[model samples]
Target: MALDKRFIGREYGPFTYTIGAEKLREFALAVGGARPGAGTPGEPPAHVSPLLYDARAAKAGPYFDLIAFPSFAVVFAVRPFSAAIADPELAVNMLMLVHGEQELEFLDVMRPGDVMTTTGRIENIFDKARMSFLVVSSESRNQTGKTVVKGTWTAVIRGG
Candidate 1:
């Protein structure tokens, strides 16, 4: 079954994701970047109070600025998207799909100790030539309700 267009505009989630400094640095290191968070450290930035160990503060440092890399949002999108793309009848394999476009607008930068959330919705779907394209928009917000980032990602569904 193809993705039901009726699902468009339907919001899914409020899923909480704790953006820990450890996780951030780990993600960075996994991609061969800096290894700053937990176990491996080189003193975080001064303003990164969240990493300070109580009164035993070491001193903060620069953290993972995801966009500086590429498509870092993948860490946050896998689950919801897996569910979204898994329409058993569609015969669509999201992996073989191409990431045609990606846009992220950040209202605020995520920081350590921040509990953020994400919600996704299908924004558009169109067919052209021999394939279909699905555009899904998801917003990540901190506990304060501040939108940390909004991602607009497109996937080309082939053989649809």
Candidate 2:
């Protein structure tokens, strides 16, 4: 089935989520360090860096708690669109859909304890070679109402 062009500008969700320090710390350590408990890059010590997992040291800096990794927006942004794609009126080809690409623009620092509100919209949709390409844009804002991240998700549905 071809995607309904009428739904191109459809919007979805203002889903809210709270960033957790422990989860942020865990994500940081997983990405930044050489290895857990190994300390291979032993010079600076992992604790000094917010991405290295030292709860106390992370707070010593300007940010009172662990700062989220730049790409952490994925955790807060994707869920809001579940309803949009699942809409019966849209009739998306779920089994034939494949993620195409993603683009994220970080507007501001996202820190732990910040309440994030994310909303998504169907920005564009097109068809070519029996495939449908859909672009969904999701924006996330902090409690203070500042946009922290903007994510553009692209999905290609085969045989559309």
Candidate 3:
């Protein structure tokens, strides 16, 4: 069965997330190829910037605080996309779904203690070559109401 194109433009929630220094460090280190152990985020690889994991360095750096990796926005920004995929009304077939693509734009760096609110909507729904495509566009704003991130998430369902 084909996905209902009528569901296009359906909006998802304004999910809120608080950024923590530890989580930011963990994410950056892990993505930078660090291995985590009992209590540490592991040794950050040479390519990983100290500003991402060293509090002192970060405190003295340009942002003057721990900064999350650019892609870290996905942590909070993906809520809307996830919600849409799980919406009962949409009836997306989980077994047949696959992430097609993702694009994120970081307007500003994310810092620890920043409260992020994300909202998204189904931007488009279409079918091609026996497949269905679901596109969700999300926007994330900081506590001060500045746009911090924008993301386009795409999901493909086979055998549309």
Worst 10 residues of 1 by lDDT: 51-60
lDDT of 2 by residue, 94-127 (tens): 8998888899999877777899999999999899
| TM-score of each model, paired residue for residue | 0.68, 0.81, 0.97
Q: lDDT for every model? A: 0.60, 0.78, 0.95
State in Å the error of residue 19, model 1.
1.1
- RMSD (Å) per prediction: 6.0, 4.3, 0.8
Q: Which stretches of candidate 2 lie over 4 Å from their true place?
A: 29-52, 62-64
Tens-digit per-residue lDDT, 28-98, candidate 3: 99999999999999998899999999999999999999999999999899999999999998998999999
Ranking by lDDT: 3, 2, 1
Candidate 1 deviant stretches above 4 angstroms: 1-4, 32-72, 77-79, 87-91
Candidate with better TM-score, 2 vs 3 = 3
Candidate ordering by TM-score (highest first): 3, 2, 1
lDDT of 2: 0.78
